[model samples]
Target chain A: MARVIVDVMLKPEILDPQGQAIARALPRLGFSGVSGVRQGKRFELELDGPADEAALSDVRKMAETLLANTVIEDFSIRVEE
Target chain B: MARVIVDVMLKPEILDPQGQAIARALPRLGFSGVSGVRQGKRFELELDGPADEAALSDVRKMAETLLANTVIEDFSIRVEE
Candidate 1:
């Protein structure tokens, strides 16, 4: 089975409260030196066939339609061996 | 500024309902051939300096203590150019 990875992250212009919270919490937890943090989603898909052009195309459509909200988030896809 | 990527994923044995929901919806949406799906989290961290061993070590602690629930999830870290 071929595996596909899709990473969906909020646009740089959008404010990410989740990321801010982590940045704020870091110092208190005794971990420092991190300047910024952004949290996002990752999807791993198992396909029945090879992750060729056709499969990747289908995955892109899936990412655009179901995996990510394109207006506020952007997604990129990668195929795994 | 150096960037580090942390990808947190559910344990292989754990049940992923969110992934299952997406898998079920794929066929109805006219997308097929996907056998399974797993959903996870990705964190992008910006640091003040290079991603050296010390920095990666600190990030690992962050991932274990805050970013990932070690009981049910596993995380991997990568340094980005």
Candidate 2:
């Protein structure tokens, strides 16, 4: 089986309160120096066969449809050989 | 700013219905060949300065506290130089 990796991140313009919360909490925890934090997602797919164009295309469509909200997020895919 | 990448994934024994759903939906969408799916999370911290050991240790503590549930999830940290 092949592996498919998808990385999803929020757009820079979007406000990520979760990340901001991390940034703010850091100082309190005595860990200063972190300017910011951005939280995202990663998905791995174990395909039954080879990682080919058709599988990639289908996964892309799936990303657009379910994995991400195209309006405020962006995603990239990498298929392992 | 330096970057800290955290990769979080479900433990092998845990059930991931969300991923299973994706596997089931793929064939219906006319995209066969996927054997399994696993979903995880990634957090990127844009530090104000260099990614040192102290910063990493702090982030690891935070991961244990807020970022992940140690019960069923496993997380690893990578600090960018």
Candidate 3:
């Protein structure tokens, strides 16, 4: 089976409440050096079949349509054995 | 400024309801090639100082204590310009 890793990140202009909350929590937790934090999503997909060219294309299509919100987020895909 | 990326993933034995929900929704959305999906969190941290060795060590400490749960999750850190 071939494994695909998809990273979905919000656009630069978007405000991430989750990240902001984490940033705020860090200082209280004694980690005062961190200036900012942005949170995103990562998806690891194990495909049923081969990791061929066609499979890569199919995975990209899936990422574009379902895994990420194209208007507000950007996604990147990588293949791992 | 320095950027650090932290990858947080649940343990293999842990049940990921979010990933399961996404997998189930994929077929309904007409993207049926995905066999299994595991979801995780990605954190991008912006530090106030340079990306030096000291900064790297500090960030790793932050990840170990606050960014990941060692009992049920694992985290990896990376430095980027």
Off by more than 4 A, model 3: none
lDDT of 1 by residue, A1-81 (tens): 799999999999999999999999999999989999999999999999999899999999999999999999999999877
Q: Go through the candidates in order and give the C-alpha RMSD of each one to the true structure.
A: 0.5, 2.1, 1.8
Q: Output per-candidate TM-scores for chain A, rounded to 2 decimals.
A: 0.98, 0.90, 0.91
lDDT of each: 0.97, 0.83, 0.87
Clashing pairs in 2: A35-B48
lDDT of 1 by residue, B1-81 (tens): 799999999999999999999999999999999999999999999998899999999999999999999999999999988
Per-residue lDDT of A47-80 in model 3, one digit per residue for the tens?
8887788888888888888889999998888887
Best by TM-score: 1
Extract clashing residue pairs from model 3.
none
TM-score, one value per model = 0.99, 0.86, 0.88
Candidate 2 per-residue lDDT, tens place, B2-66, comes to: 88888788987999988888788877877777788888888987877677777788778878877
Clashing residue pairs, candidate 1?
A: none
Model 1 / residue A40 / CA error / Å: 0.2
For candidate 1, the docking band is high
Candidates in descending DockQ order: 1, 3, 2
**Candidate with maximal DockQ:** 1
